[model samples]
Target: MEKHVSVKMINRFDTCSSWFHHLTNKEMSVKRLYRTDACGNRFCPICTWKTAKKNAIKISILMEAVKEIEGKEFLFLTLTAPSVSGEELCDEIDQFNKAVNRLFKRRNVERVVKGYIRKLEVTTDQEKYITEKLYKRKKDYYDWRGLKVGDPNPTYNTYHPHMHIIVAVNKSYFGNRDAISKSEWLEMWRDCMNDNSITQVDAKKVRATETSNSNAVLEIAKYSAKGSDLYHSEAVFDTFYMALKRRQLIVYSGMMKDYAKKFKNGELDRFKKENEDEYTHLLQSVWKGSTYDSKLRELTQEEMEMYNERAKFIEEGDEVE
Candidate 1:
């Protein structure tokens, strides 16, 4: 199974510990907290749903930004190569970026369609297993006795690790046109992929079978506060939404109980509702799932000491225990 970290679980522990520390020392104060859910599937549904919801919000934000810049055409591209170790994969990604930049410069289309490389990482073994399960199948043969079981479907051993690119094209370049043709765009994309010295999957084939009409939007949504599948087909969104909703409800109940002790029930409910509504709207926004770097600021002496301690521990490869 794919391994993923659980941000919610960690935060839960951290919050409890912080509260305990606060009780012991009245002067103790809480610092800014950021929660990152582990990508692994082992975490509770609460964490997963929260992560997914955040992703949706991020995507919504990005879409809004893109919409603001009028006359931009979006293209979804994939670059693939043989699977390799994580370090090598990172290097390849850097090289691919340089190649893309060079190709765009030469074509004088750099400004027209800028390429954004979102994720570049080695595919996990678990992902490979799942892919195999979904693609492979047993066969059957027609015979006098009706249908007879045949040999297993042939499996392709050439599994290529791939990266996805989302390119936004300036609509001004295609002046007076709604969008570029699939074949024309595919040819350009193929050439760009080849120029980057990256393995190119057949864009035409993929596009032909793509179920979603807004592939670029969906790609961005995948990384957004809500999950990518949320914007997929209605059926898929319904199924995923229901599952996640149950988890969120449980978490909400716990949060309500925790707050009830400190504040009036009506006031606590209002506060919770406000947060929930804000988060919901954020998910619906165009910049659904994205992170911005925090502004640089000086750290206090105590903060510096804590940072140094954490760094030393990390460098020594020692757990807090």
Candidate 2:
């Protein structure tokens, strides 16, 4: 019923990667297969999963860096106001981001938390969306024709947008006598938003694991919105595109802001080590719609020599005289 890019999105996903290269070392072990032609579309399920995994790894690197520097602590915070309609979604998010900025600017807030990373998430309510559509007698319209929104609780649900935040702090934040309490945080958020109706706020310490990475950061590194929500209907999809397109969903503040710049410079990014001396060759595979048909074959002597020469050239990074 609405103008959307669903057709284009479907086409993009259908032809995401037609070929995959399987690489193996001299040890005869398959190093993971390589498929680099991903469409990189945010809505593509395949690309979204890939992005999430990469982000999780990069964020873990950041957490590990923090851990190395005197064992800094982390806290996962969830702030909610109220759901808004698709029409109001974009502006609502703008206000949400502003309120978060206002909260961080507070002397009290700045005193305890060191740096933070924030992620914005928008979700749609399919069941309630349809039920309400009929109730409002929307005559085959699009753009959430007569959707009811702004209700903290709804019969089904509406377009619910919220923030998932992770704040890094010093070790003494929790043990100090002047530490902030749970109720105080709720009040501060309400004041920042200028909406006393904001009652559902959650803040908790990130529990430590044997690994350097904290599990709480995964919540921040995940997708900006649920795939199920967008694929529910054209209206939902269009609304999300309009609301989130060109918006900065991930945010870093204070000391974390410096880390963000470092991240892009590859300082905090993770890369797999490739050994050129191992003499690895690639196995070619072609996609047959659902599955990849392996075209495995032992390399001929000539092919092996070619692979070695290419690897040597790459390692040397110079042309032969």
Q: Top model by lDDT, which number?
A: 2
Candidate 2 Cα errors over 4 Å, as ranges: 1-13, 25-29, 129-157, 210-214, 266-279, 297-321
**Cα lDDT tens digits for candidate 1, 199-307:** 3442322231332324543443342123332343454344333323323211111222333232333332222211110010001111123533332334455754554
Each prediction's number of clashing residue pairs:
31, 0
The ten-residue window of minimal lDDT in model 2 covers 312-321
Task: Note the residue pairs that clash in candidate 2.
Answer: none
TM-score of 2: 0.76
Error of 1 at 106 (Å): 3.8
TM-score of each: 0.38, 0.76
lDDT of each: 0.35, 0.69
Tens-place lDDT per residue, model 2, 1-321, is 224457766676667767766444545563443334566778777777777776676666666677565478777889887777778888888888899999988898888888988999887665544454444543333334443433222424467788988888888887686567778889999998888987678888877772234556677777888888877777778888888877877788877777767767866534322335543456677888778886655566786676655443221211112
